[model samples]
Target: MMEIRMILGLFLMITAASGWNVTFESPTVTVHMHETLSVAFTAIVTEADVANGTVVVSTTRESVASVDDLPVLDSSTVNDLVWSSNLVVSGNFLGNADILLSIVSPDQENKTSDALSVIVIREERIIDTLFTVFVAVMVSIMYINFGAAMDWPLCKRTLKRPIGPTIGFVCQFVWMPLLSYGIGLVLFPDDPELRLGMFFAGVSPAGGASNIWTVILGGNLNLSVTMTTISTLAAFGMMPLWIFTLGSTIFNSANLGVPYSRIAMFAVGLVIPLGIGFLIQKKLPRVSRILVRILKPLCSLLIIAIIVFAIITNLYLFQLFSWRIIVAGIGLPWLGYLFGYLLALVLRQPGPDITAISVETGVQNTGISIFLLRFSLPQPAADLTTIAPVSVAIMTPIPLTILWIVKLIMDRRKKSIAASAEKLQGSTEPIPTVSASTKTDNTENP
Candidate 1:
């Protein structure tokens, strides 16, 4: 009985927090221009004492649309349907518009329902199962590999700088979380799943895989490992906090179920493989090198597979992503890279720490994002929002790969020049002098 009451109280809090106003049967009504659609509104007569003496309907903007008939209260419903109203958005509107219904009583009592947004445009099919599956598989493999790739010895870096972890924590918790929500609002405003996805993605720890990139990019691997460890360890508390904070403050949907089980599973996923990898590294360094080399390439292939399978699964949608999503994909990593470098510079960080932070900031574990999207959210929400993290994953490795290739090429050239100079010096021949005609003016020719 006590547990039941507690559950009931929690339910009540959720209901109260879910934005209750004059109840509309549907908060969103879509109709084409010059077409008509009816919306039903209701109120509780006992609680609100709501009545309908006259009905007035108004659109948010002038000359765009109109509504008709305020609903009346129904006493028949003991606990529900205390009152009702009917309104219509006339086909006069062509763009998105909001509508409000006003019920005025004989005693001069006026009650208004919350604004019901009428989308004045046609809606289309948004997602397919094939694309969603491709996304899930791709992200899952990468995360699994991240766990398996861990070398315990390689995981910790000796850092001369004391505050790198703190700086990374601030950026992960503060800058990125806010940026993610703002980005979500702009790119996928109508998608609640996306809002949740972006928020969680931001709050999630720096990717373990980023340490791989930091080593390649000439960043401080020790700093990278330390920051990654710090951020990831901190995630248990930080993720839920950001999710609830961002959700309640922005979307008014604190009632969205937090996937505590999934979060626990994710934590397990991170720890176990890394723990196993550490054992292998300690016992068999030779085996560890071979495994890391193999895992690195395998992870790269997984990234490519994600893109290829995504494109093949829904070729039409892949090519037809709205401009906003495309920009989001390419732009997010770029922002992380830029801001991270600048912040590190301000902190007077060593070169390795700067590179590590920049990469870590840009690279998030898509696995965590995918896990939340797959299990935490309901259908269609998961499918639609998976794109955000997939985008992050896709962009994360690209710049690093390009930079690595460039570094290799430059190193090869430097080595070639050094080798040629050495060969010339060891030729055991007299050194070549200036040509006789060219040097006559400046040299004493013997």
Candidate 2:
């Protein structure tokens, strides 16, 4: 237990150091057209042994100038820092423009800080607002389905089986990501955007709500909890390595740009929410339960809302490249579940184990994917944001539907066997026949 706690603590620290504590000094700014503006930003470090870190800062200013138009007047680095770049903003400068800054440290593996930003006043429209709504809707549906499943007595029963939960956790955190990456190679061979999307999905640890899913599926709750804890802790390092290694290998093969800082940010977003959830679960189980009940639905709704909004916002992109994105989107999640189940079967796991593994393997941390898509990809901001959520949105309903079908089939089979046994026993029993002749004979004899 002490070792586990230590490991967990280490995991949190790594995640916090690598992924969290990213903030913009001024997220929003206003400046006049044709005026040179400068903004100061800071990257605050909060962890130890950070080795080297990089920061990418960007702004939206299509109306005023292209990114090249904004150039850094002066740049300097201090405290074990080796590299820094001054951004030149270019293009039409009418409304809003973005300035980007990147920082890299060579030898430090601890907490570090940097500051950079640019000045330009452009009208900012709420982009992907509708998509946000769609994400919400999908999150809601998932929560409802999950909540209903939790009401089943079999849920608890299934969870009590040890092998099931253990296998489930292993498959989810360890195997599923590998499978997703392999599949991405086949499906999006030449497309960096799609490949990265798939890879990101694979690397993210299972969401906190997976514990709830385990309970719903009747897998051992303690095992699920343990797995969730362990996997999340493991994800701190695993996610970064996966993103860096796989992203570079695959995206480089395709000549697609992979942004490291953005990926780090994505990891941070996932880890923070998850860490908070774990802390809550540990410190206050009852409160955590209530929050889960509330947040699960909210997450489902948010996911659905994001999907619908993506469709609408990117209607043009979809119209042009619908087949490519659609096929990959639909295929990835199903593939995830399929491979997950296959792995469990190969391991000779029991039914409950199979179910737990299936859920864990099939569900990717879509939220992380969204953050990556929005921030990291080389594509236009609108295009990447519009398409990223499709991966999760398209895939979310599938496993739930399949699980429901499996449950129904299993239940019917169980009932039929029970009924058949009862019928056979009744048939074997001798029936006592009270014949009229017997009564008459008895009376006469008497």
Over 55-116, each residue of candidate 1 has an lDDT whose tens digit, in order, gives 44545543345554334444443256355556656755334556655444556445555678
In candidate 2 the C-alpha lDDT for residue 305 amounts to: 55
Best model number under lDDT: 1
RMSD of 1: 11.4
Instruction: Encode model 2's per-residue lDDT on 390-445: one tens digit a residue.
Output: 65557556667676678779988999999999999988968799999999999999
TM agreement with the true structure for every prediction: 0.58, 0.54
State the C-alpha lDDT per candidate: 0.62, 0.54
- The TM-score measured for candidate 2 stands at 0.54
